[model samples]
Target chain A: MSRLKYDDVETGATIPERTFPVRRLDLVRYAGASGDFNPIHWNERFAKSVGLPDVIAHGMFTMAEAGRLITDWTGDPGSVVDYSVRFSAPVVVPDDDQGAEITVGGKVKSKNDDGTVTVMLTARSAGAKVLAKASAVVRLA
Target chain B: MAINPDYLGREYPAPEVYEVTRGKIREFAEAIDDLNPVYLDRASAKAMGHPDVIAPPTFPVILGMAGSALAIADPDLGVDFSRVVHGDQGFHYSRPLYAGDVLSTVTRITGIKALGGNELLTLETVAEAADGEHVVTASMMLVVRGS
Candidate 1:
């Protein structure tokens, strides 16, 4: 898939926002697949024993979900050349069908001469920011 | 217990070979709730210039964490495995990882510091192809809480 062209992208253009549902079952699957096996992501009791409010989503899981926000915008996952994020807050997942909701939004920060664009992202969960200074450098068409 | 600041500057050799495959990539993609066709369909991935299905940008975290075992698992590091939490992550890609690529990662302890009774350790992992070409660098921060 061809990525968004650098010429067509304008600075400050807002990418469409997206919200993802993170449930305990999703956490289990993520743990199995990612090999994180962090109990704070799946076992509420263990998480509580460790001082977490509840079972929390893996920081990498949250980051990957937010990264889809950038790839989805470009229509190509490989176009993302550099991606980084700081885990600011935990996404506490309750034992429920509804679980937790993480909403991701982004804006084109700048179009570099190197055929890439810097995108600044904002990710929030439960009304608190979960990722800080989140951004990615995407190669455009 | 606190993370062993003494381990700073330590470099761990690459672990066993990790081969990129469609199955692992697909599983990881689904786990992240991303259903990008290029991660599953070879023809579609070829259409985008990759030899085969390409893993997501963050997929290297799997290998990165595996490389962590080389250091974080060391008893002398003083890491309370139970208290460790991911602090941040950064991925700089030399090229997109696709199916059939074999990779190895070398991990180094680059930074160690304390904050609010927590010890933060920085791991800089560089993944290289068999030919010794760099693939991606996964810079991860791990916070080990002090009791």
Candidate 2:
């Protein structure tokens, strides 16, 4: 069941904007789950030693969070057949109750004749672009 | 540290078979705060025509990154894990990965270049199902910052 209808999809239609909070604990969980235990993502000491401003969110974490725009919009997690992004900037997570906030939003870039639509995505952290040239090709009903 | 360009175009096979399980899918989804039923409920996923609970599009990162371990760990390649930062990532899916699908990936260093004293390494990982069907290909770019 394609939750997104090709006939109903309009180019330039806006997908709802959402914000996801990225905390150190979230990174820890993501590290354990994803098996990416690079210390820069969790250890503040290691992060600074390497010249990073602070412990940073895994680029994949930011990518996953931004991808929700497509999943939530299509009502199907698997609807996205293609997704890619350039890591313009790292999402640095501070050790605090309130961590970094990644705000994600997108629009229907185009509807392809191949039963899919292109979504142009934007993600920002601390008002700085985190993901550049983000886009996804999603199948429609 | 400068990377050895000789490692370019070298391919490494996945160290092990990565079995797709609902538990792993759920854990990954929950980790990303994505609780889509298609990743949690097998019945609902099957209802949607998926063989089983399907993984998120980015889930392949686990397999691809894991497969890259051997290649990235080679001292000759001169990759300093501490200095590496992700530059870009992409996934082209032949089809969604569902629970019960076993997979393995072959990782190849597609390119290595120097830009502003930083080493940019491009790795491409192609995943295949146990049945020999191509599942997806994940391409990644890593930037090794200048010391």
Candidate 3:
């Protein structure tokens, strides 16, 4: 799929926000996919034993959600050339109504001379920025 | 719980060769809901100058952590798995990972510091192809809360 060219983008351009509800089952599926069988991620009893308030989502899973936010916005997930982030906090997956709502949005920070755009992202959960300082560099196709 | 600052600078053995395949890469891409064709289509990847299907930039973490987990999960390392939280992760790539490449990673404990009631352990994993070409470096920071 053809993607947005870097020259076509402008600084301060905001990608539409995308939200993913993280549920208990998502964590189970992620555990199987990731092989990170940490009890804090899926086993409530084990999490309690370890002092975690409840089952938490894996950092990678959260990162993926943030990544999807960027890719989904750019209209081409493959446009992403380089991405990095600081995991600021945990996304605790509540078994209740609200669950873990991961809201992602991004702003085009700069259009590089090398035909790439630097995008800054914000992933929030529980009213706090979960993936803070998230940024990616995408090459326009 | 306490993480020994002395554990800093310890390097772990490189992981065994992990051959990148379209299937595993596809599964990971699916899990992330990423529909990037270059990640699974060899033809598309080749057109982009990649040897084969390219793995997603984040996929290396799967293999990178295998080597670092030994140190992070070590009970003697003073990390209380019960109170541990993944704090941050960052990656620097020399080149994209492509299918059919045999990759290995060398993990090192980059830093250890106490953050008031918690201890933060930082690890850097460098993934290299069999030919000794650098592929990616993944940096992960885990914070273990003290009781």
Fraction of native contacts (fnat) of each candidate = 0.81, 0.84, 0.41
Candidate 3's displacement at residue B74, Å, is: 4.1
List the per-model TM-score of the A chain. 0.97, 0.97, 0.90
Query: Which stretches in model 1 have alpha-carbon errors above 4 Å?
Result: none
lDDT score of model 3? 0.79
Instruction: Give Cα distance to truth, residue B136, candidate 3, Å.
Output: 0.8
Clashing pairs in 1: none
Q: Considering just chain B, what TM-score does every model have?
A: 0.95, 0.97, 0.93
Off by over 4 Å in 3: A73-81, A96-99, A113-115, B44-49, B74-76
* Per-residue lDDT of model 2, residues B46-145, tens digit only: 8787889999999999988776888789899999998999999999999999999999889999989999989999999999998899999999999999
Pairs that clash in candidate 3: none
Please, what are the lDDT tens digits per residue for candidate 3 over residues A20-87?
88888777776666667778988878877777778888888888888876665565544666788888
Fraction of real interface contacts that model 2 preserves:
0.84
The candidate that wins on DockQ is 2
lDDT of 1 by residue, A1-141 (tens): 556778899999999899999999999999999898978898889999999999999999899989999998898898989999999999999999999999999999999989999999999999999999899999988
Name the DockQ score for candidate 3.
0.49
Candidate 3 residues B89-111, lDDT tens each? 87777777777878888889998
Candidate 2 regions with alpha-carbon error over 4 angstroms: none
lDDT of 2 by residue, A1-141 (tens): 347778899999999889999999999999999999999999999999999999999999999999988998888877888999999999999999899999999999999989999999999999899999999999877
